[model samples]
Target chain A: MSGPAVVFDKVSLELGGTRILDNVSFRIESGALHCIVGANGGGKTSLIRSLLGQMPHSGQIRLEGESLGPVGYVPQVLDFDRNVPMTVRDVMALLTQRKPAFLGSSREHRAGVDAALKRMGVLEKELRPFGGLSGGERQRVLFAQALEPAPSLLILDEPCANIDEPGARIVEDVVLELNAKGVTVVWINHDWDQVRKLAHSVTGINRKVMFHGVPSEVLTWAEPKAMVS
Target chain B: MNTIYESIRLTLQGLAANGTLPQAFTYQFVINALLCTLLIGPLLGALGTMIVVKRMAFFSQAVGNAALTGVAIGILLGESYTSPYISMFSFCILFGIALKYTQYRTNLSNDSLIGVFLSISLAFGASLLLYVSAKINTHVMESVLFGSILAVDYTDMNILLVVTLIASLVVLPLYNQMLLASLNPSLAHARGIRVRLLEYVFVVLVTIVTVACLKIIGAVLVEALLLIPAAAARNISRTLGGFVAGSVIIATLSCILGVLMPMQLGLPVPTGGAIVLVAALVFVVTTVMRTTLSRFRATGV
Candidate 1:
């Protein structure tokens, strides 16, 4: 319960006969804001998937320190036929409520859902169909879902992608607040400016861990040309 | 079975006593057919919502098509051509699982996979049907393909009843998990929901329903019953509850209307075709209503 929050030792992944990540190794400290930066198709999502146990990988991924209780994941934008009618409350109920959603949500969980939505500034849209919400609004709702029960490690994949300026600010604020409350955050980020401002530590990954250190030092060490190309 | 028939007869007689139904409706065959529809309609409506949400329309269609092959195999195995429940259920369930497993393992899109399975099943069924044509009466094949509600015997009714009960029990508790898996499988998996297992269960359930209702709805039009009601409901619903409820209502209405209209009008149309046509009409109306409402809202009228 006192060691690093996550330890990735010699992690290698080969997907569909292509090497996605090779010999990647890193350790994320407990209660620290860690940002992962990599170019497109550079195994950023693959690395997260490996950590989430969604993909097969070789080597060790140990979630140490305090039992690693209840990791929250805010996945990328949902890719589905949005025409399937489902409201935000329905989605939340699918995740949080134990009973069947078709039977209707229990009153006990409604207040909790409302509180979470309010925190994400989407309380009014709680009853709106998820397909009808704007992309930014959907992102906020997803964030709200992840925040429920307060995960020990919150893993977000491109939390700001396709979000408006105000939505981005709201995300930043919520992330900072979670980090301040001792929630370990592993963010996959694209904006270097935000990484510099928010990340306690930054790791440059391009199929492997190229650099890992404090944000300032890692920023100087990770050259864009070397990492991406 | 006799008691069931007697009770249905009495019910129809009582309705006739109150001048609710004509004397023609009290016949045993008519009563049996109506009871079968009552059992199958709401279940189809409920399951169809998930079928549409998960984009498994073609998959269900493939299952339906596979039922023909199942029947053909049953005939080849020397089972009664008229009631081939064993081979039909086994073959369709296996076929559905294989389709699902192949889709999971390969990169083929769902529709393409279903198309492949559909073609293969149809080819197999056609050849077997031709081979068995000399041994069995052709009218049996016609009934399997296009449905004959008059053939909904006591055994078929009991199977439908048991299937409806089992399907309700299994699907009701797992409904949310299945919906979650359909909406976002990775998230559901992260939450410890067995996404793959749930998917297989859903596929098998669709197979069961398709096979059970084949005698009344036919192999060719069963998927239509599974798809059109949900599609129409989706056109008007804003929430999952409303979508499911609307689908049930539309499906039940379509089933009743499809059956009674043909009987009342003395039309010689296949019951399955009649049901599908009714569902299609509902879909068209709902689509038009949705478009009109959206347009009116946009124009502030």
Candidate 2:
């Protein structure tokens, strides 16, 4: 439990004959706030997808020296066909994969959903259509959904995209709070300021691990151009 | 002549006259309609929801069109209309499975495969129908093309009811799994929800429901049953459960109106067309209501 929560050993990824991640290696320890920064198409998303096992990779990824539990993913946004009806809580319940005998949320599930939504500050809109949510609110609900089953590692990719300053700050604060509570955080962001503020360790990735280690050390070695412009 | 307008009036009157009693009576047609409703309502409702969600109406259309060959083959072999549904189900399933499985194999897109199957199936069905024209009843051909409530029999109703029940039973148990897979398959797979199995299961359920509804809605218009009600429901409902309830309500009303109208008023209109027309009307009305309500809420009125 005290060891690294996730380890990527020489992982390489190719999509459409294009090398996305080449010989990337890194380790994220439990309760560690790990920030990953890169320019556009820097294999940040690719690495995250590989961790989630969405893409085929040439190397191995271990979770806590063992296989990872379902890595709870908080997407940048949940832009479902706005016409497809669903509630914030319904999407959360989808994480559990349980069926209801009748219409609507079951009582027990409702209670759990209530707590999760309240924690994420979107409890009142639980019945609202998911597509109607504002960018920040949607991100919060996704956070609630990801945390509903208490995932071991929370992987967020560009969650601050298309949001106001206040919303971005709110997400950073929540992520920081969660990291403090022993959840390993793998945040892929283009905001270097946020990374310096939240990440215990930083990884500057561009198809490979350019720099890795303590935030201060990585910052010294990572050139200004290598970070987000 | 305002046949359409007059038809609508007569249909409403028929619904009023049928009363709760007939629907409560549980005779073959009524029972069958209810059974068909129970079976088809959810299956189509769920599939329709997915269609609306995934924007897969074209794919569903392709599958429905391809079913024509199965029906034609069944009739050529001296089978009843109901029996052809099985063949339709099998053929559509095979075609859909093939289309989906070959998705990652080649550069040929999924839509291209759908288009290919759709054109071929339509041509095959048309040719078979022409070949068997002498033996086939004109009314039967019309029913197959446009749909007919009058042609629904006990056997067809039983099949529809049973299939609906079984499909619902299976899907109800895996609701979360299916929803998860639909919304985000990769995430769902990582969660240990067998994504592949659920995808095939969903296609099979849709095929069965398409076959069940063929007699009532016919091949051409059945996708409407899977799209319109769900689409209309989505315009108003904010929750998944509310969306489903809205779809069922709209579909049941459309089916009943479609059937009872022509019967009570002696209209020559087809049941499937009536259903589609009613659903379209409902869609417009729902949109208006949603806009009005949201405006009212916004204005603090």
Candidate 3:
């Protein structure tokens, strides 16, 4: 199914009497690989949170177009303890299976989960305890979970931050493959090189939209460097 | 219920007559206590896994202590001193919900909020106990603090059975969703799992179990049963299933032995203390086992 277009109109977020986002407005076309770039603590993540309805924000945020299906999210980091006995496969089952994760991975979703893992090149680590995985592997697993049941709209928070170059390639390839199938991919990134190299369109945010256009049109580094710096 | 009890009593009597069973098995209170354990042991163990996973050990403990206020309020408000099920449950549920609601509204760390609530409830319950103490046997108050398996009766068992059924039905099918919610609320919400509702369900589940088992596990030490067994299971477990299973086994054995061992040895130990001590022993043993296993792996021996 084709993905939906996203529209954010005059969205403003305030937390603890401090304005985190100010009248952020942008549109992401359907099937577009949209990159949102910004500096640390620059309201990029807050804008995503507001989009996901996790934060109470003012103004209208709407998904436009047909077949608006389930949203797939991969947060920057999973806030789990080091001692939990959850394995990589267990995490997969936790996201996909109807059975309790304690019962182990279910039969119906196992093949699909394995395929997703194999695509990310970490299928060998399926049995490894989630706490034992490397940061890169954990990030890949986060990316893998967004595939099944194959989300039409995938929201990724720094998907390539912890991964090395080859792992980043795997992510970029998979994300582009999904985009080719009309999936709307909203990626929050810090790497300007990646944004210039890959994104269909880019939005630079620092409490508001710093800049927005296709990569060719907005590749000027001065504005983004100043906004992010 | 009486007929069921009579039949079990008769069967135990027959075993005693045949010299195959201890005479304690035929006693009414012993049978009631065992039945209570059979229901509560697994429930506490299962819920304990989620409590540990969610890092809500202190929250569960606070709810357990709220049972003291529940009982004190129940007694003063003209509920039966022997079985104050209604008041005890409602008050504890209110306490649990209010605490959870306030958690989201406040900037205080969860521990601080829980500590504040715990202190107030204990102070309130203790002060009220003075007024209610004159109307009931001091033994009832002692059991409320430290628990007494021997104090359970047919009515208590029936209440426990219904509660066990309700908690199990809600928990079993939704266990995965609830875990998903606790582990990552945003993911669960994205998955359309109703994270907030599942959280409320868990709080109520903990509250009812705490209130229901007050007479057997006591207000002061009840969370120990919920935490220790799950912690022990976590020590050696390599997977979620094994963790839950190990917890349930440790808890069931602990509860049964806690009640029976005191009687078998003619010791005057309180049921809650015995149960927690047994679970604590298991926790220590598992911790040692895990350390040894890791050390051996490190040495490649």
Give, for candidate 2 chain A, the lowest lDDT window spanning 10 residues. A220-229
Each candidate: what lDDT?
0.83, 0.70, 0.83
RMSD of each: 2.7, 6.4, 2.3
lDDT of 3 by residue, A1-229 (tens): 6798999999999999999999999999998999998888889888887777777899999999877887888888777785787778888988987888888888888888999999999899887788878888999998898888788899998988789889999998998899898899999988888888889999988888888999878866576678655
For model 2, how does the per-residue alpha-carbon lDDT over A87-112 read when each residue is reduced to its tens digit?
Answer: 66667766653754226566656676
Model 2: DockQ against the native?
0.38
Per-residue CA lDDT of model 1 for B33-75, tens digit only, reads: 7788787779989999998878778876677778888888898
TM-score (chain B only), all candidates: 0.93, 0.79, 0.92
Winner by TM-score: 3
lDDT of 2: 0.70
Error of 2 at B223 (Å): 1.4
Question: In lDDT terms, how accurate is model 1?
Answer: 0.83
Writing each residue's lDDT as its tens digit, candidate 2 over B26-139 gives: 233543444455456556766677666655676767776766777777777777754566677777888777766765456465468668767987888778878667776645
Instruction: State in Å the error of residue B73, model 1.
Output: 1.5
Worst 10 residues of 2 chain B by lDDT: B22-31
Error of 1 at A113 (Å): 1.2
If you assessed candidate 3 against the hidden native complex, which CAPRI class would it receive? medium
Docking quality tier of candidate 1?
medium
